[model samples]
Target chain A: DAGITQSPRHKVTETGTPVTLRCHQTENHRYMYWYRQDPGHGLRLIHYSYGVKDTDKGEVSDGYSVSRSKTEDFLLTLESATSSQTSVYFCAITQLLAGGRNEQFFGPGTRLTVL
Target chain B: DQQVKQNSPSLSVQEGRISILNCDYTNSMFDYFLWYKKYPAEGPTFLISISSIKDKNEDGRFTVFLNKSAKHLSLHIVPSQPGDSAVYFCAARIFGASGTYKYIFGTGTRLKVLA
Candidate 1:
């Protein structure tokens, strides 16, 4: 297992409230990603960071945002929690070897519920 | 439109039987494919992978076959065990493009191994 941890493994918030999920990794990996898993949707990328202060939006980035101010931390925030945003969120870090085989290691996950 | 699709939402297999999971993709640019397994309450973990250059790759009890002409891939688990019961996701990555290493995942198929 990777030395990755997600804060507040479980959270429940109300609609229109702001919620932030934090992902911290002991490994100084250069690539970090955030994904949400929902029924019939498997895992969808929410946002990802390639380096400190460098982030990009994914296919489902409409309702989410991410930031990576340091090498070991990546944060995902929901500006206003919605019922549709309730799901299991996972943080992952990618390690690329010289052969270009990029393997991703995942955190346990964070379960968020919006009422 | 979903670039990757896992048509079968679930599958069941008896212990010591062969389990087959299928996946299809619509993007021609996707050249690398991978399979990941996930148990409830945990994040997905990499299982096996096959590059587009090769049609097949095997690791122990797991084998991945790719059909580029059909734009499909399948994962076969021989002599399935109860421990193998989990949700399987098919993912792909497009190369030759900057920042395209992000994976596109299928909805996933839940596999159950009955003892």
Candidate 2:
């Protein structure tokens, strides 16, 4: 909700197919993160970018890839979509709050279903 | 293995009453902890946080208490309202080898404040 938007609020894809979710921000923040939320698992980071053209893997990076070519956009791509990858994806940007600590603000979310 | 764990799956509390959410972490290296609140179809929002140096932190209606010896933290909401009904997730940060901090989240506990 903090100047962040994620495209395709709801998406349905088939297994073995590829899916890419887009995250765009107007804040021009330096950090962007991709995460997935499942029923049992809260939210697991898929990838994060510290700056443009710079990215790093998270705990659950398998079957997922990320690209950040521009300062305002970060993309998450599932090379081969699987049922296990079906979850609500969220994009977040980090900023330093008044408390002098970094806090993350998230986009609404994109619900991806793989059948 | 889950480094951060929230044992309660769900909790129901009446309006104007108090609600308590608990979280535990296994990683001793984690010195900072945060609490996030998520509504349906929305992204998780930062709530309150406590550092290892402080045993408690309070912000208006929400309070976070930390116990270093027990490696546990609890969120307390006084006079819980229906609007407060949502899922809460606990997160922990561990310094990564890449010089960037990585956050690990718990499974989450759904809170339903009855009107």
lDDT (Cα atoms) of all candidates against the true structure: 0.91, 0.92
What number of clashing residue pairs does each candidate have, in the order they appear?
0, 0
Quality class of the docking in candidate 2, CAPRI style: high
RMSD of each: 1.4, 1.3
For residues B1-115, write the lDDT of model 1, one tens digit per residue. 9999999999999999999999999998897888999999899999998888889999999999999999999999998999999999999986423454688899999999999
Model 1 misplaced regions, further than 4 Å: B95-100
Candidate 1 has a DockQ of 0.74
Q: Mind giving the per-residue lDDT tens digits that candidate 1 earns over A1-115?
A: 5789998899999999999999999989998889999998989988888899988877799989888999999999999999999999999998776655667888999999999
lDDT of 2 by residue, A11-110 (tens): 9999999999999999889989999998898899999988998888998999999999999999999999999998999999988567546678899999
Docking class of 1: medium
lDDT of 1 at A34: 95
Q: What is the DockQ for all candidates, taken in turn?
A: 0.74, 0.84
Query: Which 10 consecutive positions of candidate 2 chain B have the poorest summed lDDT?
Result: B93-102
